[model samples]
Target: MQLTDRQNNIIAIVKNNEPISSQNIAKELGLSRTAIRSDLSLLTMLELLDAKPKVGYYLKKGKKLTNIDDLLEKPVSEFMSSPVSVEENQSIYDTTIKLFMEDVGTVFVTDTEEELTGIISRKDLLKMSIGHGNLKKTPVSLAMTRMPNIISVKKNEKFIDVLEKIVDNEIDSLPVIDNKKIVGRVSKTILLQTIMNIAKKF
Candidate 1:
């Protein structure tokens, strides 16, 4: 089920054992009945557990993962990393070196005002250096995937929704923008790893 952390813990306590009273659960969790009442009610409503008069609670047959949200609607901010960046005026030679040094596949490009203007991938740099032959003479801007064409996400965007954008755009990563500037980034690597962990539990 798409449960919050506290709700999941409540389920675990009930699952690992059985026929536990709400009073016992609250005491075990160091919470008051008043604190966990809503979670208990919701779990009972979902039929994940059964309650009987004076008997408290017992585990119902699990229909788990059938209701579990794969992504749990987590915000992209939780997975964001600092984006490796380059100036719009920097040479492709410098940009290429920074790309390797930062160990990121893409470099977000910004102007003198620190406003995002473009983005460059290793493929973009490789194509320019190999095809044009003069890396030092060409600004990164000359080969960059320019702004207004960049598909970006916000800090609060859900991970699953952003995953769709990444696959649809065929991109390895996207810059996280806020207030018209880059804040952080999220990538396919982290997305895949996170979901793989969830799948394992399922």
Candidate 2:
């Protein structure tokens, strides 16, 4: 079961103050007791918390905290967005325009056959621009990080694995490859949004 952020916060409060009252929990969260009434009820129904007459809620003994393992194990294909790509030979000026138009932090670079070849980041373009390079005359290839060094994820890869790659590499996004072709792209924003959406559902 996936616990919403509020639910997790409630759990922490109860853990630290086992005899905490609903009023106190709401106060810690800057919400009214009525506002969190449903959350408290749900947690109780889930057996994660217990209530006593004239007392407040408390963590149920031996009950495990909620986990998002199922959500994290979801495939990348379910959350990846359409990739914003540029041809290897496309001019830096054009690529920069496309990047802004799409509002993406990174863009995939492809060859004539549309095969993935490299990746260009906003930082890369910024560095080149600051150096007074002629953007219109420079090919995106000159500003891209070429393959053999690029970190990519497969379509069926788990979200947890993709997150690890992004964090370890300090990258903003990754291209999703299938059959050696770029099918989609995954980014920190997408993953975060996925979690936020799930929280909203509950």
Candidate 3:
């Protein structure tokens, strides 16, 4: 969408100091909160912004094939998700609800000591339910894909490398690992957002 000079200015401010709240933007721009919110909503709908709830909004990053190539040659942690994990044995039903509620497609399955055991996805649960036809009696472990061979990305890996893994493997995400433990998940959504962030450079 075409942006007005004022809108461009707002984007610039956010780019410089992102994760700033609507109220803060309103005060800084000397505009009404309603106006700021309107701008933010429009920008977000346009996919030019991303809000992390309590973390506020950030400029979406975008990248080209060349950029992706360069990214693959760089460190992965540059855009990796922060470590966030959930325990294993958390029923598939509950886990499904949690994934939807959290707006994440996958969650790492960990043991009591937080060691990675498996990876679970909404699709995995759906497949299990549709085929085995029973979830009430099935544990997440039964539906989870075991580890040791689970795909993963290191914090220092690059986006291109991760992209190759995802596209070539037809998987939605890769768990970020360190010392054989899952620290986070890298999904297509996060990759898209990182690309949007790069686009804002225009």
- Prediction-by-prediction clash tally: 0, 0, 14
Best by TM-score: 2
lDDT of 2 by residue, 1-202 (tens): 6679999899999999888889899999999999999999999998989999778788888766435688799999999999999999899999999999999999999998889999999999998899888999999999899998999999889999999999999999999999878999999999889887766653
Off by over 4 Å in 2: 1-49, 53-66
What's the candidate order when arranged by decreasing lDDT?
A: 2, 1, 3
lDDT of 1: 0.86
* Clash pairs (backbone) in predicted model 1: none
At residue 5, what lDDT does model 2 achieve? 96
Relative to the true structure, candidate 3 reaches a TM of 0.61
Name the lDDT value of residue 14 in candidate 1. 86
For 98-189, candidate 3 gives per-residue lDDT tens digits of 77778777777888988888888778978876775456556688778888768899888888888889889888878988888776678888
Give candidate 3 misplaced runs (Cα > 4 Å): 1-70, 131-134
Scored by lDDT, model 3 comes in at 0.76
lDDT of each: 0.86, 0.91, 0.76
> Which 10 consecutive positions of candidate 3 have the poorest summed lDDT?
63-72
Question: Against the hidden true structure, what lDDT does model 2 obtain?
Answer: 0.91
- Largest lDDT belongs to which candidate? 2
